[model samples]
Target: MPSFLQVAVLLAVVITAAKGAGALSKRLGQPAVFGELLAGILLGPTLLDVLHWPVFTDPPYLERLTRDLAELGVIFLMFLAGLETDLEEMRKVGAAAFFGAVGGVALPFLAGTALGLAFGFPLYESIFIGTILTATSVSITAQTLLELGRLRSREGTTILGSAVIDDVMGIVILSVVVALHQAGLAGAGDAAGGAAAVAAGSSGSTAAAQGADAGGAGALAVGLIVLRMVAFFAAAIAAGRWLLPPILRRAARWPGTEPQFAMALVAGLLLAVAAEELGGVAAITGSYMAGVMLTLVPDVKRAVEERLAVLAYGFFVPIFFVNIGLETDLLDAVAASGPAFLVLILLAAALGKIVGSGSGVRPFGFTWMEALRVGIGMVSRGEVALIVAGIGLQEGVISQAVFSVMVVMTLFTTLITPILLRWSFGRAPGSPSGAAAFSPAPGPRSGEAD
Candidate 1:
């Protein structure tokens, strides 16, 4: 465990650097997140290692503490995002959102898989790499749009809705890919055991029986995973509709906002834990669902959002963005993967999202410029990408070098997304028409940026 003093000092440095960098970024007309990310890189191995700094190098405990805090940051950030989402807006753009999400996921996945294969990676590795490319982090884009005062516009809502759908699709794909990989491993083990038993002429029947059992188990596991996911969403939605609103309403009457905030936070955390523990879904997804559930309660949504934003944006969220940079070693990653590989992967990531998502929204009556704006908005892959990459690294599916390359790719995409989105919005035909055009029946805090 890290001592209190060590943790405190580490946080102090992190917060100071993050805020300073963020301020600098704002001065440069960029989102504060960019500066925070850059601050993390400067304080991390990329720069600190050269300077022999101990902030990230000499203390394992500090690193762990930072990671834990960062995870909390992401949970709160996602929860806030969910709270801010306009379900009515999403409904209006449902067709466009669905197609955009599908195209965004499919094209990137296929392109990434093909690239991985071209690089001579194993089948599983290739698939995992492809999976990484499917994630879309819209928070950055949302912030940029908010800065440009276009977040409530039609294109903005479309991007937000599509990004939400994109996340759902990405999680489902990840679950399926992971399950399939496990099944493959089990089959390989069974095959090896069966082969060995047959060579020794020692009870091939037992090996065959075990292989059958293993196969059955794998199938059962996959089935259960799918079922769990369905059950989790069903339960969350049901609770949101029937249980949570009343509870929040009651909590809203409790003298001050603290009670309501506490109730919301507890509910969000509980659902998040349950989602991961019982449903085997990502905790962020659970938290996001919880936020969405609360959004249905028009009376208390703004209070909850206002209360939570102070804690989230003030501290935890910045840490999450910065932590992404701290964990990545850009130079080492590029050196190991080769500049060509990095450049190719980066290009693939960017174009796959822009073209795929852009093409998906064209049939929805959006002009080419509007579709391009939506596509550009979905190009930033932040927390979700990092989480997926981290899982892959932990499971030994992707090497450290690949993980580093992914980190750099994520950072690059995140940094450039705001600039690209701003440009796209500028070139987009027509002025910002506010939220009324997209969602006439605004849910609680619906038009706020994620």
Candidate 2:
């Protein structure tokens, strides 16, 4: 591990770059996060390759620390977002958000799968591509909206709501594909060994038995994943509705520095851990839920809002954005894939969210431009796509080429969403319905789970 001295230097560099770049970006009329993210890319292999510097080289110790810290940033941002969310306002746009998310998820999945197959990839691989495309990391969007002071707008609420739904759908879809991939491997292995068993003359049933076992296992996994998802939602909502309020209410009376506020932060962290370890969902999901649940209590919301905003926006959240750029390698993969290939995959990933989500919300109360903004906001697949791509690579369900393309797509989408959102929201007309719901600048994807 790096010494504290070294760690301090690393932290200083990351924070300085993030804040400095953010300021520059704001001056350029873009979101500060855009600059923070761009700064990360500049610090990474795309330019300086900072991690390879002598200071950070201990078999990824600093690298891991950076990721963990970035992840914490993501959690903080999402938690604050939850605090700012107006439940009643979200409810007003619930159907539109739901339908929009459904469309956002469905169309990209189909398009990605078809594109994979068109290139002659295998069945499971094709499905995995579709699944990868289904992710909609809303972290960038949430931050951008916060920057623009639009977090309380109708479009903002709807986008936030749709992201939650989008993540659940994406996670569930990934689970199904993972099961199928595992089962396919199991069946293939069994079949390969079947001839040997047949030669032994005592095991005509070997292949059948193993196939049955594999099928059962696959189905069991998918079932458990779905069950866990359902259980998490139920428990989170129930506890938020009942359990948390009293605990927080009591905490509010304590002499500690914003005791109830501290408790709320703890609850968010605990739920974030649970979301990953038990709920079979992203950690951000839990944190965001914690924020949402805490919002029901006026005291906790007031306290947390006062305390968390500075910590999140001032420090951690910028790291979260910067770390995204730090982790990316935008050129190598794109250069290898050729222009036509890049354009095809990029278009498939981008349009899926834009066309699907946009149309989904348009049928409700949104204007065409507003719907377009919603679609643009959902385009960045963020960190979740990287997770899915990593899994596919580990399972041998996608080639390095495919994985690289995903990385490139993720980079493009992440870099573009903030800019697109600013453009789209800028053109959108202001109104009282959305304006009245405005709360403090809370920040989001179900994000870095984004």
Candidate 3:
């Protein structure tokens, strides 16, 4: 088959699988994202590969195409992620979210670093482990809340607010790590490679000669990255707020709003491209900021959201989730880390966010129980963790083994979140148990307005 035709056919199958699985998950009282993830695992090397699903057995370039489609999914997902955030509500929970983000990052890094020292894996791998733990998959968490009709509630708002902050902080950390990894500093490469560098840097003239260059390069790279990121964001936000509204206002008056779609399309694509070219920032991130800034114009915001939703959820989101499954290599993680380490990493991954983000709510006047609930609510790692893990694998910062553990971690946390939340709110006020009577009724998809 022609390449484009092959991709189209493969995506159709994957979406059918994801949608069926998603429906099944919702029927079972779980989030659709959970089903989508499960679909990935099943279609992956673990089981259904024997059935010869195209994505599982595709050639490299085809796989690359699938991944590119998936990247678009990520962008749309991030855009919706930006849309769902409420800055005003976040301000109320700001103190707690800030602390939570800090603690979430710190504890995982420290614990992972210490574990690496003890396990003999070297520092870089340890950092990767910690980085994996640092993410709070906002999509999964929001899905859970929306399912329970809690997305509009106090606790839901708090958790959502905290998650946005957590995500922003996570991206910043990723930027730094990616920059360091690229510059051949921060232990050079993976566990084996980094160990060699550490040894040479400690004892060899070669290491000494390269140290200054690595340090200088890393510094310059980080500086350029920060400046570019800031500039892109500043420009997008300012233009979005100051310039976009007037332009959109005029666009609305045009004879055909199909033109509005074109404008929106151009705006999203251009903003995304600009962000990448100018600052090396994820285009989705920049696009999301653009969305957020323009949210004040309700009519324009609603129109863009309506058009984007059909494109995003219908096509891109499913593509992204399915790609996650295809990329997962569960056996490798088990082989590398061994069972015991796997168990430890999973536990740390689950608890790290809970303790960090949960405890940080104390200064924000939330009850201990409320804080705990928020922490548990945020436990679902979902797609973003997998995205980071994929990046780590491609960069060779983590072996297939670590990536496998992350897949397991991501799936486990996502699967269990709804059950956990339901248990905690067992017949309590504002739980999904009370969902039927929720003021704004729950929608078919997560985070969609009634």
Score each candidate by Cα lDDT.
0.78, 0.76, 0.70
On lDDT, the candidate that comes out on top is: 1
* Pairs clashing within candidate 3: 332-401, 333-401
TM-score of each: 0.86, 0.78, 0.85
Q: By TM-score, highest first, what's the ranking?
A: 1, 3, 2
Find the candidate with the highest TM-score and give its number: 1
lDDT for 336 in candidate 1 is 82
Number of clashing residue pairs, candidate 1 = 0
Task: Provide the lDDT at 214 for model 2.
Answer: 61
Off by over 4 Å in 2: 57-59, 120-132, 135-202, 365-450
lDDT of 2 by residue, 236-278 (tens): 9999999999998898789867788788889999998998788
Superposed on all Cα atoms, model 3 deviates from the true structure by an RMSD in Å of: 4.7
Task: Quickly count the clashes in candidate 3.
Answer: 2
- List the candidates ranked by lDDT, beginning with the highest: 1, 2, 3
Candidate 2: clashing pairs of residues = 447-450
Model 1 lDDT vs. the true structure?
0.78
